[model samples]
Target chain A: MTAEEWEDFRKGHPKAASLKTVPLPFPELCATLFDGNAATGNPSQCLKLQHSAVIRIQTSRTLEEPKEDNMAKFSIATVFIASISLLLTLTHSFSLENPTDRRILVLVDDLALKSSHSIFFSSLQARGFELDFKLSDDPKIALQRYGQHLYDGLILFSPSTERFGGSLDVAAILDFVDSGKDLIVAADANASDLIRNIAAECGIDFDEDPSAVVIDHGSYAVSETEGDHTLIAADDFIQSDVLLGSTKIEAPVLFKGIGHSLNPANSLVLKVLSGSPSAYSANPKSKLSSPPSLSGSSISLVSVVQARNNARIVFSGSLDLFSNKFFKSTVQKAGSSHKFAKSGNQQFATEISKWVFHERGHLKAVNVRHHRVGETDEPAIYRINDDLEYLVEIYEWSGSNWEPYVANDVQVQFYMMSPYVLKTMSNNKKGLYLASFKVPDVYGVFQFKVEYQRLGYTSLSLAKQIPVRPFRHNEYERFIPTAFPYYGASFSTMAGFLIFSFVYLYSK
Target chain B: MGRSPTTKDDAQALFQSLRSAYAATPTNLKIIDLYVVFAVSTAVIQVVYMAIVGSFPFNSFLSGVLSCVGTAVLAVCLRIQVNKENKEFKDLPPERAFADFVLCNLVLHLVIMNFLG
Candidate 1:
């Protein structure tokens, strides 16, 4: 049996997992016990199963088990039952510490999206994610069952869904993100209030006009016929290698959707795809009597937010951006003769989804250690001027494994009420960051702090408290050469007093 | 023109009379006067030395200067009490004043020695 199959069996029958180490010589005997026959102490049942096993082994002697249907079934069942009795263990459900999202729940407005956006879904599936598809109004759907999250991430493709069924609501979804789960939301021109509210909570404000669609006459895609200029060939993507893969996306992504304005107060939100300078959002059918609310390069085509909990969310202005039509379509920007053989939408969607799902840019810091110079063991309290070394190992999740995150700007701060020493750490190219500094002369409770916040990477905020003490009484210098004159003068004064008193009394 | 000669003669006369008056002072009182001058000069010398060299050992510097000043002041008190011309302390014996000065000097020297380091 494969590891995944063994894991599934172990999860399904935890009671039998403990008995796995006790080698089951008779598979038929264990099958009876596992099938709710523990109370039935019948010896004849085991004998009957043993008789069946002998017949199967004799028929499958040539090892061509696939040719015999009954033999294959019996042999596979025996292997599964044997593996199921072997181990009981605990597993994480896509934790941030693990930084790998294994399961996802995709909610759609229509079931036809399973066929329309099959490419994007298939890419996630190919990456080993178990995606559960459900209609937006499916009453039996739930994010968590028995207080345990059923999915590690949520993908909202239902731009027109006004109310989600079951226990999931605006607050429930927000709560899910607060607990460090990932989310991906796609909105169309007729985005309902529910979808808009979710986007607004993520620091993205969709155009207030419900019918408004992003219309760009300057940089619209070059179509065969003169259209309403809603199909935009946007190319302004955020310059980040960690969010977007290292290989550059050469073509402009095709977007046919509404536009949004990121909240200025929200510092965590980033504009992944921005509208062109001439792009504006309004009802394309009506006359432009007033200026559009969101226009110019400020209009965001796609945005992403990384919460303080490290949960990631991506908001796209168009749901059709993930459709097969856009993924397979060729793109040509207006006034540009050069045409891209394929749209950049597929690469853009794949890379950005990798980021939102924590496959990239996820960082973990461990084994934080500090000790006095020339000493291997850490002291409880540091002397005022003792030199010390601060070390921390930081690694980035590379989808399949942790890799060394090499950056020249990682820093460590020796902080009390304020930073006393702020030094940039030097990495050994093996993920170990080192910074050595002398303890400040001032004595108080101090902390070794590392507040690393970089663009497109999970922020690392670590603070380890330490105490600093002044020198002991015996630690002071016994004698100083500089104070010799004062010492001589004082002693001379004592001698002079004794001599003058004797002289005065004897002579007079 | 004759006024210059008169001025020079007047200054000479003043000096002669001051010398005559000081010569009448008792030998013990004169010795105390010399002691006060010696103590005062020593303190001045130490202060000048402190200025030349930085006052790194501040407590030692203070004790050194205070010891000299205390000795000078006690000597002056003894001189005052022993002077028969000064009647304010006539009832107090000169020996008693001498004993008091000795005891005070001993205490001052002990404190200065302790503070020198």
Candidate 2:
């Protein structure tokens, strides 16, 4: 048929036109054809099959038409592609409202390290993370393609690589973090300058002596070789349930790498693991040089930083901490008879990975609402001495899902120039936190602020401004009985004037 | 500090002269003076009551004291206009003064009633 004739035919038969546009499943199409043919009573089964056959034939014929039909077909194809791209863009946007990152990119120096660290990698995979392992020097590797990040997190295990390929540099890695992505960096003894620079950017300074390794002669793990006291056993972990799992780690962790010190000015960086008081960083092969630069509790074995944007990062001085060998190795600290069959590396690695991947400590607060007591609708402004209740729903991302975050320290402040009402909120065990307090007996522009910062959770800072007004003139109580004497005196004065007036004018 | 009969005689003479002068005043003026004295004493009594009972109802205290003070003032104005010896208000009539006093008292009572609460 000609194009005009086909258009007219489609308009005349509305049912056929709709069927052509919306491709239905076979069974549903059969049902629809059967229903349509039921009224005619003309052998419905045969008619249903015949209708579907006719539609297939018409669609095929339309596709094989001349170039004159290309305009309409091209527009339809373009619309379909556009809608799919829009849907993908919507899913790719990073937002704290949904604190789950699905994809990760792991960079390693050698392919053999992948097998050595398979325990750590498998743990991440079992948690629903799509890990893409690539060599650090791969020329085609790129963090973003066409202004879209391919992964939500980056793991740097290539401590020896001097430089990265493609557009990946220290700045590019920092840019990824600035866009609210997580990072986990592992460096070893004699780490390359590039890795040291990245650690420096995160407010950590590695020991300047390249040969220096963290040596704890007093707390060194008892090994069979009895070599230089370079292998230290670290038991001083940060006392935080969120960073480390709730189950206490009984065995000390094994460390055989360089040590770092945190920058005093950077408050965001926290020393998650520290060396023993007898531990010091000095050249293991050479004699004792000038005093060690990093010693005692100042040497941080592992540190974590939660950036202002909530992009978490973990820096470990030893890449072997994540290795399966270290995880399975037995550890017995010097002068201690308690021998652990398995080191604490596995649990420590898993918990720190969970934290860095935005799975443990990420918090999201939503539906912040406040209204007067016994009222449902929020008011634009409040009056002084008003009894109000504030509510907020907070959830923590537990690797795979949002779970209720329960804590007793969440507080809300009714603040103008200063806090007028500071009350600790009560929770309903279902993620809803509520506080009921009377608005202070002062009127001004005030804000309902909740600044909740826990030990390891992401800070929840919320402030909503509202105005408070004084009572209107007509709203005041009138003619109180306590002032009846004053009222009587005033009225009697008026009466006295009237009586005195009459007497003075009439008495003659 | 010597005990002298001259000092006692001087004080007695002063009281006698003051009584003689006050007795010469007109009866109507004297009646107005007595009314002023009554209002002033009532105001003093209210002040002492506030000092003892505390000014918890400050607006009531203010209205009570102001009413008595206002009455004393109006009565004094009436006394001045009807004295027949005060030359400043000789042209002004006592009835006119009483009318003004009644109007002022009415306005004062109206405000006090509103503020009493």
Give the winner by lDDT: 1
TM-score of chain A of each: 0.80, 0.82
Label model 1 with its docking quality class: acceptable
Model 2 ranges with Cα > 4 A deviation: A1-94, A139-141, A145-148, A500-508, B1-20, B23-39, B67-110
State the interface C-alpha RMSD of candidate 2: 2.2
lDDT of 2 by residue, B14-107 (tens): 9999999999987777767766777777778778877877787787779888988988987887787877888999999877877787788778
Looking at candidate 1 chain A, the ten consecutive residues that score lowest on lDDT are A86-95
Interface RMSD of each: 2.5, 2.2
User: Each candidate's lDDT (Cα)?
Assistant: 0.87, 0.86
Per-residue lDDT for B47-103 in model 1, tens only? 888898888767667877887788788888888888999999999998898888888
Whose TM-score is greatest here?
Answer: 2
Write down the lDDT that model 2 would get: 0.86
Please provide the root mean square deviation of candidate 2 (C-alpha atoms, Å): 11.6
Candidate 1 per-residue C-alpha lDDT over A126-234 given as tens digits, one digit per residue, 9 for 90 to 100: 9988899999999987888878777889999999999998888999899899988999999999999999999899899999999899999999999999999999999
TM-score of chain B of each: 0.85, 0.87
Q: Which pairs clash (backbone N, Cα, C closer than 3 Å) in model 1? A: A20-A85, A20-A86
Distance from true location, Cα of A161 in model 2, Å:
3.6
